[model samples]
Target: SGMLITGVTTLLLSLLVLALAWWASIRGAQMRSSLPPGPTPLGLLGNLLQLEFGGLDRALMKVAQTLSRNWGPIFTVWLGPRPAVVLCGYAALRDALVLQADTFSGRGAMPVFQRFTRGNGIVFSNGPRWRTLRNFALGTLKEFGMGTRSIEEHIMEEAACLLGEFQATNGTPLDPQRLLDNAVSNVICSAVFGKRYGYEDPEFLRLLELFNDNFRIMSSRWGEVYNIFPSLLDWLPGPHHQIFQNFEELRTFISEQIQQHQETRKFGEPHDFIDCFLDQMDKVLAPQDPESHFQEETLVMTTHNLFFGGTETTSTTLLCLTDSCPAQVQAELDAVVGRARAPCLEDRVRLPYTNAVLHEIQRFISVLPLGLPRALTRDTHLRSHFLPKGTMVIPLLVSAHRDPTQFKDPDCFNPTNFLDERGEFQSNEAFMPFAPGKRMCLGAGLARSEIFLFLTAILQKFHLLPVESPSNIDLTPQCTGLGNVPPAFQLRLMAR
Candidate 1:
């Protein structure tokens, strides 16, 4: 018993010594390189306490604002002993992301997602694997009608279904989020699975609910804690476990879809994104070839990436816009679209107010505010600070959108930010809701089409009436770490 106790004590002491060595090494790295300065970190915990106040969404933006005043737009905050160089404001973001695109193109490690993907997928991968998968996925998505009018027609069709669902609400108070999610998800389903599921399909509903629930948990404070102390949380009991369960379910669903595609696929005649990918996999595979990115696992992860990306942000943006500025948007839709036919992408040019409103909604809410973390591909100089290779970067996209120098009223929800002197739909470099540069969202075009068509179709068919007074509604998100998920509220969809 005495010898056993001695052995355990020896192991504990060794671990403590190793931890000290690691902490010392991190401090050494900070001292060796001229990293931008911020509040001093507390040993291992870092500035988690400071950045985790209220909600990470608001806290991170606030921290950047406060630090930028002293440290300029580029500054550093230690996220559990690992320092992250945050790029705040429009100029800083543009200079680094746009100017030095290649150097800052690496995908940073996000523990929450890394656990699920294991760095296998495009979203959280870097270098050759990422490049190969991303290019293939982009080409396939485009061939399957992502940016062109072919995809636009698909969005419009989904919009019609969404309108029907809203019409069936019978003008009673109802939460439109699930209906919006189904419509938005079906757009990606068309591209990936080559078929859209009905709103009442059990499998489709379960997948949507899984994505929604995972997003909610990830954006909560618990998610933030897990990211910071993953090793500790992995052993402890918590809500973070649910994120893995959700990922497993999504993986299973995607695997099933892939198997279905493999069995029924016609060679060379690609029906959809999955069919195209399978063809690529077959072409790349050889008896002697050892390395390949086009495997069944890659297909599954990429498909999930597409589905998750396509569903969440666009639907949340639509939900926020409808909940906040419904009356005014409906006014614009009525004046421009008139209730006769569905609104199309071409109509976007004529409806400057509606276009401007959509842009402003994305700006005000800043969905995925921090964006997926990026990594420095190589040691580089930025804004007079030395950022090292593999340094995690937070673009702080919310900061860019709300930069006071760029916008007239940065805080409030005003559509004029995207309008010119003549009230035309004007573009701004500062407006980077889909982010900017080499790693910009692959589904930007699809998301834009979905948001515009779905929103206009709903507005054309019915008027959005808030269950509570607009003034009483809280614009602050329910949880805000990874993504800014809006608070739950019902709306009365009165038929025009």
Candidate 2:
């Protein structure tokens, strides 16, 4: 009797397992039918197997480019079980993000950030919260002189300090990573915290390391896996947990700054971003309105977004300049602005070749290639496909940067890509390094100014002598996921 009961139980369990698998297949099929078509996904894994986990950003671009040939420009790919609509080539991206901006401006779930942020910050939050914080941030940043001549002065001051540091190296080959990080970070710090740290300050160095480590890990395969399976990865041991720990340390630092500001700040007088936010909070937070978004946590997260965004991307771009030293740009700099003064924003118009070189650097490296993921605000028709509200969208920014139709020989680092027949700097509609639409990077103006000022300032004073021959210097990124991390290289800065 016992033997017979065991057999019957085993048979029932098998039947139940098979039934569940069948149901999942049917459900997945229904979801796919509603979305645009791509390579058929396997059970549970979706299209994950098709991607190269180590360099997810490049792999996605390659896969999309190949699949688009058969699947059209607007097609779907399964990131785990979630379906994301990818906008390939310049036309597809422009049509969706520009022509129909509002409909495609919603923020999507990025499990890595979602876990820590919980939808509280400006970058990840959707709906009213995002709008309120974004508007407030824009106003506050402007007041701090983000896009004005005042901010340019701050950047120029920082650049002078940076040149001193490089000169201190005495033309020895050294990695400019940390020094560049410090210079770029100080610019944002002056606005956000109303102060700057010495380059060798231990505490400041520790904080920058946290930022660097988090960016690198988040741009590795470990980050890709965590985003795909956050719950499972939480139980497993890995380097990804370091990301949260770093976030906690960063949050603690920001909170401490907020506390100090609260103790020192006056009611009507504001000195920096933290002071402005505190002033706003005092006016807005009421007992009747318990769900106000201007709480302390929001302040920390928004400040974190500004600090991190302001520092990492710009610094990485500066570091990559080590690999590129076009003589024509230097010649333009020498002719237009002599060594008597430093390069300024006004110099960009006068030095067309130098301006073109900077544009080409951004276009060639294509940092943040995948960009922050976007979602649909409402049910909308894109091309021939009907995408319901809240559908995930992935804009392949690198695709547009490398779009052959928009740029000639897009793969190479040629300044002529941004120059016209008359050798004048000509702007292309597809030159969107910061992405596009309403949700585009708020710091775009500030970032562009920094890249132009810092690069020209450095080149004007020092000659970047790469350790290896220019032809042999590799421009391939160390990793490509959250951002394209330039490979590790050292260069000597000889005083010109």
Candidate 3:
């Protein structure tokens, strides 16, 4: 009788699994019917098995490129039961993100971050809340000297401090990750928190570690799985859980800073991002408008958005600068800027080779390769396919970077990709490291300035020497999901 009961139970479970898989397939088909054509999905797994999850970014580009050849540039891929339309190549991305900017402006639900963000912060939020926070943040950032001479001065000051730290290393082979993190983060810190932490500050180091830790976990396979199966992963044990814990700790730190700003800030004279936000809250928040978006929680999340976005990508890009200073770049820098004065933003045009090198680095690395997924604000048609409103769209950014039609050598690290015959820096429409259109990165301008200023400053003062031979240096990302994490490397800095 016990054996009979076990057999019956097993039969029922198998039947249940069959039913669920049938439902998932049928649902996926319906979703794909209205969307562009692509690979057929299997059960709840969708087209997941078809994708290489080990290195998601590269895997995505590979899979998308193949599928695009079959289904055209804009086609659907199933991420579990969820069907996402991928915008491959330069033309498709521009057609959607640039031509139909407002139509593709909605933020797609990234299950990993959506659980924590809950549609609140500037980056993750949509609709009125996003508009409100973004405008406010932009205004506040500008007021705090973003894109101004004042911000350039601030970056230069931080660069000088960075040089001092590098000098202290005394040509010893050292991984400059933390030092770079500190210097890059301090720029955002000055604007947001109104102060900068010392390189050895315990609290500051802990914060940086949390950011690093979360970024790594989020860029891992675990993060990819969590995005697809958040409900299941929530019950299971994994490193992805560390992401939420780190988020909580980061939120706690931000809350503490907000409290400090609240206590210290004087009315009508906003000092930093937090202060300006607090001032806005005072004007906007009232008893009648209880659902105002400018609340304390929003403040924490928006600040978190800026703090994390500002630090991680730029620092990772800096890490990718392991190659010895190119003779041409050094020569251009010497001829135009010279060693007496630091390279300024205006010198970007004067130092074409150096500028080309920076652009090539961003393009080759393609950090944030599969950029933040964009959602359709309304029903739209692209290239004979009709997509419904709220459809998730993955703008395969690396495809644009690697688009052969646009770049001379899409696969290799060649500064000539951005250089004209005259050796002058030329712009490519497909060169979008910050992503493009209405939903572009908030710190795009600041990031460009930081990259140029920081790199030029370092190369002007020191010759970067890799611990390993140039041919052996691995430029592949440590992880390639959320961001292209540069591999760990050490280099000696000999003062020029």
Candidate 4:
């Protein structure tokens, strides 16, 4: 009887503990944003369980499409306990991004963006710092011949090296992704500092490795957690902190390069980005003028941003485009642009069908499915919904590009949308592959030059070999963090 009484008491205590924990979890969900319609949240976990953490891009699109159909172009969803209003389709996105540009000006430094960048860089910084850095980068690119012969020459060099690498492979099956990443990123690196690293360079390899880590970590589900629960994460070591440490090492390397340029001190000729920066630093650091936007901090941050922002994005887009498009694109490209001619921006104009294919790849794959996670600069009204300042806004690029009303089949890979009835190239306003507005890709001109040139260069040399294999290509994008993808795979290069 005594043992039975002890057993009963222990059982009741265990039951009570579980019940209390359950109640706390349920009650923890306090955020009740009635701004727009979305799936119901579950307790303290919120809507996290609703997401397809394994395959994010597909999951996001499915939810976005369903929500848009039911709620129209604007809807709100919980990213954990936090409420975010996502903009569906281009009309809504453009209204928010372009017309209401200033109102959506702030790129609120989420905990992760803040910890990694300290709000120093262009990708994360807001307010006057962002404006100044952006304007300076713009002017610097112009001085460095972003659209002129200089940038063209830099791209051609990288292209030539890439072509040599592919030709050396002699029609073997190889993943051209890393080589392409290195080649494309090296262009920005060369511009920033007057050096083109050899393929085997240890530092260059490490930098690539670091960027890849950031890419995987940035787009993962846990990344969202870190962004939200920074206070908790700060106490313990986590991927967010590790990533920041690694990224700072990258910044340190750039700082060393800047120091070298300063010591050498050749401002008049302006050999590269560093040289130009040194020249500006001289003027900005004058005794007469104390407070300056251009400082060692800005220089390091801007350099870091360019390397971080300019690299992985362009490389990933190209990698996915090649994977998403049919192998026949290579043959079609070969017939249009011969091997004797070098691929240029002009080639994109000449090869209408190839251009169409490229455009479609960009449209269907849509790497930045959510575009950049934006923060409202002020309380604003859109589609009759009120969005308060600091609310996370996602411009839904995937939904807009795949809207059936815009294209015959928004989901299918048809190049006809980019081609006219007469088989000429046509431009669509609906296609904002890089996302639009003030925060649109800073390296737009440079990225365009590289993509068109690199794709044409490869096609001029090799045919993308088709297979008797099953559809290895999944136009479905895999989002590890906030990014989505064309499913991961490799290709074979055959000489035409």
Local distance difference test scores for all models:
0.84, 0.87, 0.88, 0.74
Candidate 1 structure quality by residue, lDDT tens digits, 1-496: 9999999999999999689767756784665367788777766767776876437657767777666678888877877767788888999999999999999899988888888888887787778999999998888787768522389898988888888888787998988889999998988888888898999999999999999998899888778788877888999998889999999989999999989988998999888888888998899898776688888888888888888787889988766665556677778888887888889999999888888888898999988888888999999999778888888888989988899999988998788888899988899999998889999998998888888898888877787778888778887888887888888878898888
lDDT by residue for model 3 (212-297), tens? 99888888999999999899899999899999999999999999999999999898988888888899899988899999999999
Name model 4 segments beyond 4 Å from true: 1-34, 42-44, 54-57, 147-149, 235-241, 287-290, 318-336, 466-470, 474-479, 485-488
- 1 against 4, candidate with superior lDDT: 1
Between prediction 3 and prediction 4, the one with superior lDDT is: 3
Model 1 misplaced regions, further than 4 Å = 1-32, 146-149, 322-325
Better lDDT candidate (1, 3) = 3
RMSD of each: 2.6, 2.7, 1.6, 4.5
**Whose lDDT is greatest here?**
3
Question: TM-score of every model?
Answer: 0.94, 0.95, 0.97, 0.87
Weakest 10 consecutive residues of candidate 2 by summed lDDT: 318-327
Regions of model 3 farther than 4 Å from truth: 1-9, 146-149
Alpha-carbon deviation at 117 in model 2, angstroms: 0.6
